[model samples]
Target: MLLVLSEQEKTSFTFLTSLPEQVYPDLVKTALSQLLSTKQITKVVNSAAAKLKVEVASLTNSSLYVLSQCLLNSAKRNLTPEDLTSSLKACGVEVTIVTPLVISYTENRDILIDIITRSTVQAPEYRSMEWRLECQVGSRSLHNTVIPNVLTKWKISDPRFNNLKTKETYLNCDVNTLQHITESLRAAQLELDTLHARKMCRNLARIG
Candidate 1:
């Protein structure tokens, strides 16, 4: 796929090509490492500029950020080196600059992919549900009344936390409300099974 670039990104990337050719490998390596790191992009760009004895603006922190994102996405999607080269060329990056970047990516693709897979955060998922029915025969204010209600507890697990935390939610509703909730949930399940909804989910997964 051809990688589309924003106007600002296109302008910023031009600054990348102007850097010394000898620095390409180190630059690409630094950019890739920074992508999987918590460090700020400015520090990386500024540090590179200092080492190269060039102005910080000349290094273009925005370009480095975009480069890192491109590398990360490409790795996540398992794009081939040839595919990455073409995509970068389509975006107007010089062959010289693309060469080292693509080389570094190819050499480290498996490692990057492993890191990404390990770092991925899964959305919370339903683990289990418990429900109970209760009948209230009478209360102090209403001596001769009956009320039926449902008490539900839902457990959800999130993989993002180190502990693999599970959250519990309690819900109380009358019979009528419980029926409505059941019907709504059934409708949602049917919607998810539809072709259109499935396709939309696939697209969202690819984007993510």
Candidate 2:
């Protein structure tokens, strides 16, 4: 996923590029070596910052971006902000704003809610309780069903979904839509449970 960097963050990128070409590779190597030895992102980052003669907090955004790229390269794939943060925590870094760098996948979650509520998912004949979502991303559109099992679906999408990297499409929009539908269904199920519990209580009262 691409980072939609803030204006300040964009300006901060110059700090990274200003370093000598050789220094960049050496810095990456040092960070990786430190990570392997100490298994702590903080130490790896601290060591790199010391080499650059900069405080860790002063170059937080630039340093974390480099570290994030390292993690992604090692993993050989893309990671969500949550996954990236978890990986960093496992290595002992505590950078908080890394998540805000990437735009939220759930930003348009309500639009999907609006679409579903306007559809026939809740109609009398549609007993499946699932809605098929036809989403358009640029010239390419995909058809996916909103189901309760999103974790499984996301697993499937992990390897197959390339639209995320494309400038013309929003892959997370479809994913978020499915996740929201799952949540709404769960809420509806809980309400049904409560009503059933009340009905059972009324039946027992009449028997007594």
Candidate 3:
């Protein structure tokens, strides 16, 4: 799939294309390496400025940020090197400039994809639920009085943690409150099954 570039991204690509063709591999390598390690690209930018005898602001503003973003998005979407090259070319980048980027992508494809997959947020899932009915037959001041309540326990699991983390919650409510809670949950479930939600899921699937 072709990448759609914003106006600012177009400017970034233009800046990259204007640089000496020989610098392409090292520049793309620095960008991808720093990104893979979750480090800032400031050093690379500063070095590039010194080598090119240009202001750091020019490179920072027109290039590095967008370059990192492009690399991250490409990895996140698991784009093939050829697809990435085509997309960059479509953005007006020269074949020479695109070559290094594709090479970096090809070399680091597995690691990049693995990191992106691991970093994706997975929603907490229901594990178990227990509930009991409680009745209060009398109060200290009043005799012959009766009240009923529901006591509920819920457990949820979050997969993001190194260990499978679990959370527990306790709730006490009257019949009306319990009914309201049940109806609210049912409504939420219905919402998820709606056409709009299905469309959104499709869109997200395409993106990921």
- The number of the candidate with the highest lDDT is 1
Q: Which candidate, 1 or 3, has the higher TM-score? A: 3
lDDT of 3 at 4: 61
Candidates, ranked, TM-score: 3, 1, 2
TM-score per model over all chains = 0.58, 0.29, 0.63
Error of 1 at 109 (Å): 2.5
lDDT tens per residue, model 1, 134-204 = 99999999988989998989998856673389988999999898889889999999999999999999877
**Model 3 poorest ten-residue lDDT run:** 155-164
What is candidate 3's CA lDDT for residue 130?
Answer: 97
lDDT of 3 at 145: 82
Candidate 2's residue-wise lDDT over 1-208, tens digit each?
3223334444444465555445554444443344334365676667767877788875455645554344433233334546544544454332332233222212323432343344423311211222245544333353463333222212122212332321221233357676687899999778767978789877664322
Ranking by lDDT: 1, 3, 2
Candidate 2 lands at a TM-score of 0.29
| Candidate 2 segments exceeding 4 Å error | 1-4, 29-38, 66-127, 130-208
**lDDT (0 to 1) per candidate:** 0.80, 0.44, 0.79
Candidate with the larger TM-score of 2 and 3: 3
Q: CA shift at 172, candidate 2, in angstroms? A: 33
TM-score, candidate number 3 = 0.63
